[model samples]
Target: MPETSGVPALAVEAPGMEPHPAMKRRAALGLALGALATPALAQAPWPNRPIRLIAPDAPGNGNDITARLLAPQFEAMLGQPMVVDNRPGAGGRIGVEAAWRAAPDGYTFLIGNAGSNGINAAIYKDLPYDLVTGFRPISMLVAGPNVLVVNRSTFPVSDVASLVTMLKARGDGYAYGSGGVGSSAHMSMELFRQRAGFVALHIPYRGTPALAQGLITGDAPVAIVNLVNVMPFIRRGEIAALAVTSLTRWPELPEVPTLDESDYPGFETMAWNGLLAPLGTPEPIVARMHETVQKIATNPMIADRVKLLGGQLVASTPDEFAARIAADVAKWRDVAQRGDIRAE
Candidate 1:
């Protein structure tokens, strides 16, 4: 053995010991780096096949419309098609539960809104999945503004103020229809009743289509529906648009005024739809898909289509989307409790 300066040399006969200190240190470092890379490499590539996007509502609903409009752009960006799966029923619970149970791969996702994500949490006594913790928010596709519409022949009121006056005079027996109990329309009208100081009966249907039919046939004289769902009827002069349920008027409906402007200062009620993946999905994949969705939202063609549907294209960051969902859940839960709203 030789002592060289501050270091000592190892004997060549030493057992289970490397004689080259530099080489030994390099080998150990290399092994550690390799071990770190293995798991990163083992994770499967995202969009390896068509991604499944579930919309709990049936076809023709806003969620379905949003998923379809963004699918083409997502396919182009992700290099795989987005297969829209509509699992309608149970007040939008079927699709949400399906998505919640899916493998936490980024390939499966859900397009959910206040009805399924926020309102359901507020009204449902037993929820199978937790909205805030069970899934990862991807991005908010749009903020859906609803229109307060009434059949032309049944309701003579023109604007929100007049409608309020009519409801007051008509007493509490008047009926208003919605997609279902605890839905945005149902909740918004409850807010309307609170703010306008009127009492109107609520009628919940299985879906919005039936609600729309009720409006058309005068089975239900008044209803609040997404601008997109009710725009065609409004244009046809079948119903009168009292006010939009947003802070500002939608660009597509420039002539229309928002609820805030309709004598109910600061009034706003908008349903939002966003993409979400099951919990435990890789963060990178979520980020990638979010970026793709942002692009789709901003695409000119997509923007045009959304406008026609009376929806604004807003692709918010995942963190912002998640925060909005959390805030809305809390906000609407309070509204539901105050109004004593429950599912029928």
Candidate 2:
């Protein structure tokens, strides 16, 4: 039988065989319906399901806290659940790798920060994903300066100058604690050490809380930690604030001079967290996420909460965030190289 594009050649019917008018009409209607449905299927609305946001740090850490705080607002704006997944390990590389490997269909994103996105990119030579090429910046949620704090009981210094003198006097005999090897805490302290020409052993802990515990218990004499995590202790007089790692003093710790004013001119380092999607995520989705986050950042309640945590709300544009990421990577790359810093 001759073929009729799978219609079976009318079964080799009599030489003049023709499809019945009723059957032809039905076939034409079916074709027309299929054609109409094609565009509808292609244009289905995005985020028809819950979005999985990967926080590349331990629970209660800066990144995880930021993700949890913003998730509700995100869900409200996107009309979908925002599920935060904490996959902490390998100095945040584990979670970041997981996010990078996920499908770029707008359902999976990362709560990237200074540690995972900036310092790690510079120090982790064998990272499974590239910070610049493997992800797209959505928006920067918040930025805060790291505070240089010391154990109130054990640390002899009371200010930046005295701390510098003590560190230089002790050489590598004294040590400082950090959240992790490639963490912002570590890099910030290394930068300060380099500027002050001091040598001190680096003690790496599991997370920010552990680092703070070490300081409180006097196991670690010094540390440069995120302002949010250490602010409460500073207020309680458990940890003494020596200086902030920003060009200018932080509003919350106005009396604590910045490193720039403490002899290290122009010194600055901030710990920031932001949203990022896999590199190939659609631009429309990226734009929508950015705009939604900006709205959340500007909300009175959210803004006030962020301020209480010693952070400044920064709903930066995608381009601006991208540029900041690039600059941070470059700046920390130099610091890491100079300090011979590497993840433990």
Best by lDDT: 2
Q: Listing every candidate in turn, what is its Cα RMSD in Å to the true structure after a full C-alpha superposition?
A: 6.0, 3.8
After superposition, the stretches of candidate 1 with alpha carbons farther than 4 Å from their true spots are: 1-40
lDDT on C-alpha atoms for all candidate structures: 0.84, 0.87
Q: Please list all clashing residue pairs in model 2, or write none if there are none.
A: none
For candidate 2, lDDT tens digit of each residue in 43-114?
789889999999987787788888888899999999999999999888888999999999999999999999
Residues 1-344, candidate 1: write the lDDT tens digits.
45663322333436886557775675577677767777988876776899999999888787898888787778888899889999998778899999999998788999998789988888888888888878899888878788889887877876877777777887645889997888888888888777778778888887787898899998888988878778888888888888888898777778889988878898877888899999999889998987788777768887887778787788899899899888888878888888998765
Candidate 1 clash figure, as a count:
0
In candidate 2, which residue ranges exceed 4 Å CA deviation?
Answer: 1-35, 153-156
List, in order, the clash count of every candidate structure: 0, 0
